[model samples]
Target chain A: MRIFTAVVAIAAGILILGGYFFPAFEGMQALLLNWAVILAGAAALVGIFNLVSVHTDKIRRQEKGSVYSALLLISLVATFLFAMILRPNHATMKIVLSGIIIPVEASLMGLLTISLLYAAVRLLRRRADLTSIIFLVTAALLILGSATLPFGNMPVLGTFVGPWITQVLALGGARGILIGVALGTLTTGLRVLFGADRPYGGN
Target chain B: MIELTIILVSAALLFGITLWKRKSPANLREIPALTRLHRTLGLSIEDGTRLHISLGTGSLLDARGGSALAGLAMLRHIAERTSVSDKPSVASAGDPTLGLLTQDTLQAGYQAAGVEELYVPTSGRVTGLSPFGYAAGAMNISQNENVSANIIIGHFGPEAALLTEASDRDNVTMIGASDELSGQSVLFASTQDSLIGEELFATGAYLGAGASHVASLTVQDILRWLVILALLGGAAVKLVGMI
Candidate 1:
């Protein structure tokens, strides 16, 4: 089964990738991608069902915070029903998104700042390596210089050092990292294409 | 055309390297993050505590899927190593497609370890749909599941801070890797150990997933140098033309 799956996966990958360089294979590629999209949508449904079952089990088991699980299930059912019946473009559905979902994610985003600060402090306390120290110092300088100071602006740190570090140093490092990431992604994709890595086949 | 040529070249190099190094173990540079992860995996098995792997919200339908694949590679190794433990490893993924694959990967790992009976499908979960929601869900698992270590590897954003913070509060050893630059920055500050940029893809190689992985690393190095040379050569050519 694994070998069968591997052969199918490799052929699909090759055809899809091949379409990019040769237009002759595009029809096959499009067909494969369409199948992928349908499969992905079904996979998402299965994932949601898995989520529902997990919470349901938690409630049945009377585990800790089962009340939360119950609440989640209720919300999930309500949203799913509303989105399905109302076609998702209805104002009621939008409110559920804007009123409930957006605000909740917004609150978490607001909380993220504090979380980042706490983590940074923890990082310094835990590691205290040269790289950590440099990272901390650079961040401190960038944050301090990022905003308009009460004095309108800092003379040195804000204007020169901050801009230099971010634009020159950080950008260069980021580009290097991006190039490395691209290389890695390429190899990984190639491996899958050549059937050397059978992540899908579980070999 | 160029992209195709590069891919073909890389494939050739990988096969060549694999055959050349088939008789001997390839020597690899030490990455402290992976070294620490190796130790943590061992400790979790010995201590009978589970390791939690967060595959993040990387959809397999897009470019972001690369990181999720890396996460799966790491999960495969962790699950196999911890398969015999009283508390087997749990994997949480944010995407449905990824969640399904993760379950299969977990099962395969258990099968490899000769303990497929102990594999639980729920152990590979789709925590949430949205980013923050996923982070919160994953955070809860590490906090409440007696997890000895947290492996956060995939595409992530600032929401990763929440997971790292939760791990920190619980004193669980956490190592993070992300394909996103923002995610990398967040991980650098938040986690004790992080695999920056392409280092995320090297997890499988470090974990001994297969010889192909090691061969791919060598290919990566060779290709990296070629890219550098091309860039420099292009600039030099342009400079001469300008003069």
Candidate 2:
């Protein structure tokens, strides 16, 4: 069974890749891709069920955050039912997305900024390496450069330093990281295709 | 034609190296994060505290699936280490499809260890589909579940900071890795030991998954050097043209 699954996966992968390069296999690729999508959707439903079951278990056991679990269940069920009944683009759906979800996410973003600043401050305390010092200095300069001065933009800090640091140094580093990730992804995909790493389960 | 040649060459090198390493296993360079992972797993079992592994918001059907699979491989190693312990490692994923895969990996690990009965469906969970929502769920687990160690190796964005911060608050031993650049930056600062760039993909190899993983890492290193040389050559050519 494992061998059969691995063979199917490799064949599907090859077909998908072939479809990208060859016009003849496009239909087959689409069919396989659609099947994968349907499977993903079904898996998502199962995940939702798993979430409900876990929370229900917590609620039943009256764990520390049982009330939170109950609240989460109520919210999930209510939102799911509303989506089914009113459809996704309804005013209520819009309100839920804009009013609740967006705000919460925005707040998390705000928290992230503060947390980053806090991490910067503690970098020295944690590691105290030359790298940490350089990171802190760079961060401090970037923050100062980006901050609005009382007499308007400081040309040296804001215009020259900020742009050079952000557009040149940071961008270069990010690009390097991206290149490495791409190579890693390619290697991982190859491993999967060759049946060496069976993430789809069997091995 | 060039792309296909490169792909075929890489595949050949990867397979050839893998077969060679099966006879004589290649020694991998030390990854401090992986070393810390070994200690963290031992600590979790000794302390009877849970180890939370977040697979991030990578879906199985998308580009992020590669990272998600890498994360799953790490989870399998973790599960094997904790299979006999009362506090087995728990995994969470942002995508439902990946979460299902995580459960399978967890079960496979336990079964390999001859402890299949200990596998629980709830051990692997889908926290949230959205990035922040997933981060929030993972943070809650890290904070409330007596998680002694938190290892996040998956595809994440800037939201990873939230998860790292949660672990920080509790003084949990945190090792963060991600394929996303923004996530790499965030985790580099926040995580005590961060796996940057391709190091995230090398976790399984570093943890002794198999010769194939090691071979893949060797191929990655060779490719990286080639990329560096190409960059330099291109720069030189551009400089000569300008002159």
Give the range of the ten consecutive residues with the poorest summed lDDT in model 2 chain B: B1-10
Model 1 clashing residue pairs (backbone): none
Relative to the true structure, candidate 1 reaches a TM of 0.96
How far does residue B189 in candidate 1 sit from its true spot (Å)?
0.7
Off by over 4 Å in 1: B241-243
lDDT of 2 by residue, A1-203 (tens): 88888999999988997787779999999999999999999998999998999889889988778788899999999999999999999999999999999999999999999998888777778888887787888888888888887987777888899899999999998899888888888888899889888876647
The docking category that best describes candidate 2 is: medium
lDDT at residue A119 of model 1 (Cα atoms): 80
**Candidate models: Cα lDDT each:** 0.88, 0.88
